[model samples]
Target: MKNIAILTLGLRHNYGGILQAAALYNFLKREGYNPVLLRKYPVQKGWKAIIIKALEILPFQNLKGFRNSYIKYINNIQFFDEYMPNQTKIMTYKSQIEEFLNKYEIDAIVVGSDQVWRYTYINDTEYDTYFLNFKLNREIKKISYAASFGIDTWEAPSENLNIKKYLSDFNAVSVRESSGQEICKKDFGKYDVELVLDPTLLIDQSFYLDMIKNKSPKNYDCITYILDENTEKKELVKKINVECQHKSVFNLLTKSSKLSVQDWVASFKSTDFIITDSFHGMVFSIIFNKDFLVIINKDRGADRFYSLCKILGLESRLVTPDSVAIDRMAPIDYSKVNEILDQLRVKSKQFLINSILE
Candidate 1:
């Protein structure tokens, strides 16, 4: 068995980060590799640093602060592993990283499942720069597996120079979206880039179902929305839910609503339709074969949904705030969606598995 240090996003409460890490971890274990998960830290001390310690409890603004701090700290970031709430419980973290590097006497380290490298998520930490220059040390092989810059745009020239310095460390790299690939090419001037699916998509529906032990949702027709972006506004969601045909509508913004990602996914599978502004909101709907309308989110890069939709050939279903008629999204071609997923599944497996084997 090879000792693999797999770094992934650790914020488990976040759907995309958690599920992507789960997919990669499960796959790596199946491949007979002992993978050690790492959580990236931006600030090392102070009560203010406590923000990341209780990220879920902190307000959205503070979460943004941690994200920004992380970007500044780690440059060649990959995957971040989510630790349990208590820090002492994960005392072996550094030791595990060192052990994995020395023990199975393995081949390489893998980073990513999502936007682990995007500077917006990194804060003020020198680790951000040195981690990318890790290659120059030449002690171990480094690879980025389906890592995302996460955003659709490029940084200014000065920042690009900082980014370019660290990107030189990767032995191979792949990104989750075309937009991110474009940024890598433009900013880092790296031509060797492959497109890989988000790790959530890397695994099949059965993988998720297996996690829940034969669970199913309440059969009622429901409309589930996780309001991460524009759709969070009360008026917009109320307007859509008021007009939709579904009997029950649920929003994550409510205090009483404590649904986990799988809970949300299960609900998506049973729902007749979905209207969402979140990226994973669209992902689960498509995975479960639910008819859904993606709201254009100007804040979180609206192009994200459209880019995924375009890749799947489902662009006609996109909805805007003024569009006002989600009822029109009915009767999506489930067969067409399956066909696209089938192709993507093959591509995803080839990209991830072959890259590892190579």
Candidate 2:
């Protein structure tokens, strides 16, 4: 079997990131490839390491409180084990990556879908503004799978020349959205930049359906609100709630102070409609065949939603940040979105399978 290394950002928790990675891995497996995950850093080790990382994650928790809360959170989730690297004894980040790679028997490396290529996502530096430019021996097939820069738009300088040069190392390259594709083309020139489905879109809806339990409470009509760290989203969600007065609105941040990626997906699926600013919010809405609105956040990265909507012929749902009147938007025809989804799913599966065979 072909051993493929899957590299991504935030495998431990971020719902959109994890789901996209999961979908890609699942699709790669379906196409007859053994996918191995390779994270940027190693999982924390020992009580001290765990405590340090937990403290790092928590915004305002004392060391003991963070540790206890983290352990409890870890125990409750099923996918936590698979999400993070198994670093029971390992101490360093470099050692962890090497150990994981050696144990998993990775033959090829596939980096991306999330912000795997962006240095800005990891650190704050001039280099961080560019793509990762670590020196590597070019022997194995290097592929990028729908990787994103995570910025709404960017224009790097001469200092980031190496970052643009690094793209040449990859055998194949794909980005999550059209804006990403444009950036790649503009910066690196045309080098096989294709728009692949997000990892969440790579898997079928049935997989998620089988995993979630106790799905909706009674015949209650629910609406999901997936927002970024944008204040405009709060206003739009309020408008949507007012428009859909009869039904209850479930804003993810408000409903659960602590929520998992799977929990978000489950909640989104249980809803009759999903209303939000998050790209994956719109993604799950499409996957579960729910009517949704993409509240465009111009400051944040909302192009992914608009790109997917355009691809799937759900153009009507794309609402600008200035669109205060939620009631003015037209109701979506989910059946048409399904038709586009079915065709894209087939094409996306074939693209990967065909590439592997070649």
Candidate 3:
């Protein structure tokens, strides 16, 4: 079996990021390959290095903070053990990452399924790493699977000429959004890139249902998975509550959220309705066949939401928070949605198989 190393976003608090990376790892393992999710952080240098060290030892990083951080870190490791068992040691510095990759002997590297290529998220300091443009001790196949540029536009810190030089290393390329295909050709001068499903959607919903099967998720008629909560969102939830009356609106990013990753999946399964601004939230809503209303959020990469929904024929589900209030309890016909999803899943998996085997 090929020893594949995944180069997506690091294991972190974001539910979607963790799930997508785990999904990719599971998918590869099921395909009879050894897949590992590399744990990494952006390299720090100069004043940034000084500040990071300072923050590590200062009043904010007191015994209390140390205890909390330790707990969170251990919990994260345990979660990965259950889902993605083959993981590298946490590497916060460039040297650590280089040493591990060299020693581990990865046969191929997959760079994506998240906003890994988003310039604002990664910035200039880590462009080469995210692009899989690093120099390794040995040659290995480099490819991007459903990698996203976050948005449709070109916003990388480097010029297209320089980016093309780095991107040329990839043996094959696949993007999560349709917009990324155009950007691949126009900005990076790479054509024939395949557009594929997000890693989360590549797997079956039964797998996710199994995640919550033991959790005994609480019953709720409605829930809001708002990524960016605001007055408008609060008001919208209030309106939805009038119809649902079991409003359990919570931002998983919030410090107060004790909802585990598996619990979040369960929430999607238990709820009858979903109102969300997040791209993955909508993805899960569709995956679980729940009625949903999407908040138009260009700031959060609406292109991802648009591309997936457009192909699945769920355009009517999208609504701006400012739109005239409509009936939130209307049923969504997911018959065609499931059909389109099944068809896409086949092609998406085939793309990965060809990308790997070719």
Best candidate, lDDT: 3
lDDT of 1: 0.63
Q: Rate residue 166 of model 1 by lDDT.
A: 61
Question: Over 4 Å off in model 2, which ranges?
Answer: 42-77, 82-104, 124-138, 213-220, 229-232, 328-330
The lDDT values for all models are: 0.63, 0.63, 0.80
Q: Of the candidates shown, which would achieve the greatest TM-score relative to the real structure?
A: 3
Which candidate, 2 or 3, has the higher TM-score?
A: 3
Answer with 2 or 3, whichever has the higher lDDT.
3
> Taking the tens digit of each residue's C-alpha lDDT, what string does model 1 give over 323-352?
755464457787987888788878877766
**Candidate 2 TM-score over all chains jointly:** 0.80
| Lowest-sum lDDT 10-residue window in model 3 | 62-71
Per-residue CA lDDT of model 3 for 49-104, tens digit only, reads 67655654555354434434444555666678899988888776556666777887
Q: C-alpha displacement of 35 in model 1, angstroms?
A: 2.7
Model 2 over residues 202-285: C-alpha lDDT tens digits? 778877886566455333355655545466666766776678763655556552346665666678767777777777777788
